[model samples]
Target: MADNQLGEFLRARRGAVSPDTVGVPAHGARRVAGLRREEVAVLAGVNADYYARLEQGRERRPSAQVLDALGHALRLDPDARAHLHRLAGTAPVLPLGRTPDRVSPALRRLLDGFPGSPAYVVNRTLDVLAANTLAEVLHSPFSDLDNLARMTFLDPAGRRFHTRWDRTAQAVVGHLRESSGLDPDSPRLRALVRTLCADSPDFAGLWHTHTVRGKTHDAKHFLHPDVGPLTLTYLALDVRDAPGQQLIVYQAEPSGPDAEALALLAALA
Candidate 1:
């Protein structure tokens, strides 16, 4: 078991919260960013010593009740809570090794039908396994298109492409966390993490936090060099047959400027 990883996650979550944020009154100047260990212990209904041991790797396995309490205390969302469960081996299934990365032909045909909407498939590690023509056109000259995570952090155009780069980058890392927790032994996932940790400080810092964020329907902004600017909503649907693959589709709201931009881009493509 990776005791240190769990310890690091606990510390990061602790450091992310502040006393005032959780309704605790501040007495004086503080050193750490978030609630102190004692405060977390109190809020979590556990003693400081026990919590400390859990954070220090002495306590490898925590009960479901304790983890649930900690989740509530830390204000974790559904995805984050699920990820915490996986990290603690309380999840439904723990995958043993690396999974396949192939995309089926039927899914590819479905993607091809979407001429206006941008659609693509991504693996657990956020690699773009398959994409429709519209998606390719909308992306517009990526420095590296092999992996979504790598493109978001390492590519020079990541900032311009994402528009809201900070949030988008963090979400990418969070997805990586969600994936890693479920399949801790994935060689591809481990190799990708090692490379990003070595090359990008932003990616390295976010990965340590154990913040998991599974993609859902959300507004996205992009500044394409060719199309200028576009705003769209995206949905991430799990490919039921593929264990680690997701079908993501992006489309602008009808009767909006963004939709017009999509039309123009489609014509150009």
Candidate 2:
């Protein structure tokens, strides 16, 4: 875990916000990257010294209201704001490095229930913990089904498999950011992030952005080698029995060309 993750988060977010975005007039060339320290203090309705202390790790505990104000000042989305609270030690910290390999029998049965749709279970690191037969068939382009981050950024076939590779990369990085905040002490998560940052420049750029997002309902585009182009909608639902796990189910429009493509993968499965 980082010694001062809260401070790092504040600095990254502070540098990401532009003066013009917050109505801070830019009369001359500024040396600072994003919003000046005093500018953030003023916008957040806090003292400059206090805000600086927060960023410097001199002040560790900030009230929920204060965090909320700072979140607003940083223009954080709902996920990022939640991450801010988590980093401040104000929110519930999720357990990490638990028995990630254990998938409930019921959940495994549920994945099989979706014959037409591709369904899978993933942990915080986006490891494919469990996948249905069709899901495995759909992701056949990847050399391994071990990690989504590796496949999306490192695998050569990732570019062709995911039609919207850029969007997929951003979402993957954002989701990992959220996971980092929740489980700062997870060495596995940290190592995975470091490997990606060192090996993939695209992952490095997105990781530095400090974007926080959790998987949710979204449309995904894919180009299966055997089935051609497909557009599918997916829902990512939290697994109540497993703390850091999500069950993702992907489906195409009924009787549409996408559905036919997905059916072809199902047949292959």
Candidate 3:
């Protein structure tokens, strides 16, 4: 992790914002992309020097109100705004270090219950903590299903398995960014990120974007070797007892082609 994550986030997000989007008139040719520091200060309703200090790491703590204003100026979404607050030290931080690796018996039962569906448990780092039989079958293409990041970037089968590889890459990177903001001191996360960045140029480029998101309800498209093409909608639920654990279940519509594919896959499993 970078020493000055707050500054790094601010700088990266600042560069991402378009001057035209914020109504900052582009006078002529500008040396730097995005809005200038002074423009951001004006939009955020703060002194230019103060904002500069905030970005340079000379000032660390910022009030919630100021962080809100900055978030607005940066055009951050709910997740990104929360990430900004976290970076500014205004948001409540999670307990330092890695979360518990064990998945609860109840969750394991839930996964087992979904014999027709593909279900799995993953932590903030996207480690496949626990998976149902169907999920194991669904992800059998990967060399190892231990960590999703590794599977997506390191394994050759990831690109072939995921129909929308580009979108999957973005979602994985965004999820990592969201997790890192909440638990910055996790050695597991740090090492995983380091390994991915070193080994995969795709991961390295997306990591620098600083996109923050958590897995939620979304449709996933996959190309299975045995079943051909399968599309399933997934719901990601945060385990109430576990702070960072997310239980993801993928389901296909009843009586649909996808459901047939899933059924065939389950039979094979």
lDDT of 1 by residue, 1-269 (tens): 14476677778888888777798899888988888888999999998999999889888789889889998898888998887777777876453434458899999999998888999999888889999988988886686568988888888889879889998888899888888777777778889999999999999888877788887778888998878889999999988778778899998989989999999999988
| Alpha-carbon lDDT, every model | 0.85, 0.91, 0.91
Among residues 3 or more apart in sequence or in different chains, the pairs in candidate 3 whose N, CA or C atoms overlap within 3 Å are none
Q: Which ten residues in a row have the lowest lDDT in candidate 3?
A: 91-100
- In angstroms, give how far residue 80 of model 1 lies from its true place: 1.1
Residue 261 of model 3: what lDDT?
A: 97
TM-score of each: 0.94, 0.95, 0.96
Residue-by-residue lDDT tens digits, candidate 2, 1-269: 36878888898899999898999999788998999899999999999999999989999999999999999999999999999999998898775445366899999999999998899999989999999899898999999887999999999999999999999999999999999888887888989998998999999999887888989999999998899999999999999778888999999999889988888888888
Ranked by TM-score, the better of candidates 2 and 3 is 3
Reference-based TM-score, model 3: 0.96
Could you tell me how far off, in angstroms, the CA of residue 143 lies in candidate 2 after the best superposition? Answer: 0.3
Relative to the true structure, candidate 2 reaches a TM of 0.95
Q: Provide the lowest-lDDT 10-residue window in model 1.
A: 91-100
| Top candidate when judged by TM-score against the true structure | 3
Residue 252 error for model 3, in Å? 1.2
Off by over 4 Å in 1: 1-3, 93-98
